[model samples]
Target: MLTIQFLCPLPNGLHARPAWELKEQCSQWQSEVTFINHRQNAKADAKSSLALIGTG
Candidate 1:
């Protein structure tokens, strides 16, 4: 498994457009993908835009 951790550099963060872009990129992967919001203690399946929006 590959793991990475980073902060959102964008002022508006994720929203919808970027979230869809991210979802598209992650879709190319064969492994499971997840978004972990350390500050909010939230976890979401990276394939879902609605779940990612909450982490923002």
Candidate 2:
């Protein structure tokens, strides 16, 4: 598994609009994508809208 750390450049962070965009972007990837918020110690499936919202 490849683990990458990226800083969110979003001004308002990952809100609904951006999350949906991310969901679309993740669809293009063949590999499984997951987002981990270490600060909150929470994780979410990058393909899941509900899951991503939980991280917010």
Candidate 3:
């Protein structure tokens, strides 16, 4: 498993469009991916649309 922190470069942060694109990119990777918002104590599957949305 590889942990990656995806910083939101957009002013709006990881909105719908970018989030979907991120999921697509993550899905292409061979390793498992997961995203965690340390501040919010939130976690999500980096490859799932629903989970990606939860990151926002």
In order, the Cα lDDT scores of the candidates are 0.80, 0.82, 0.73
> For candidate 2, lDDT tens digit of each residue in 1-56?
88888888765458888788888888789999998866677899999877877786
When 2 and 3 are scored with lDDT, the better candidate is 2
| Model 1, span 1-56: residue lDDT tens | 78988687776457898888878888898889999877677888888888887786
Q: Between the candidate structures 1 and 3, which one is better when assessed by lDDT? A: 1
Order the candidates by TM-score, highest first — what do you get? 1, 2, 3
User: Which candidate has the highest lDDT of all?
Assistant: 2
lDDT of 1: 0.80
Model 2 misplaced stretches (Cα beyond 4 Å): 10-12
Model 3 steric clash total: 0
**Model 3 lDDT, residue 1, Cα:** 43
What are the TM-scores, per candidate, against the unseen true structure?
0.80, 0.78, 0.71
- Tens digit of lDDT per residue, candidate 3, span 1-56? 44456565555446777778878988998887887766557778888878867765
Number of backbone clashes in candidate 1: 0
Pull out the clashing pairs in model 2.
none
Better candidate by TM-score, 1 or 2: 1
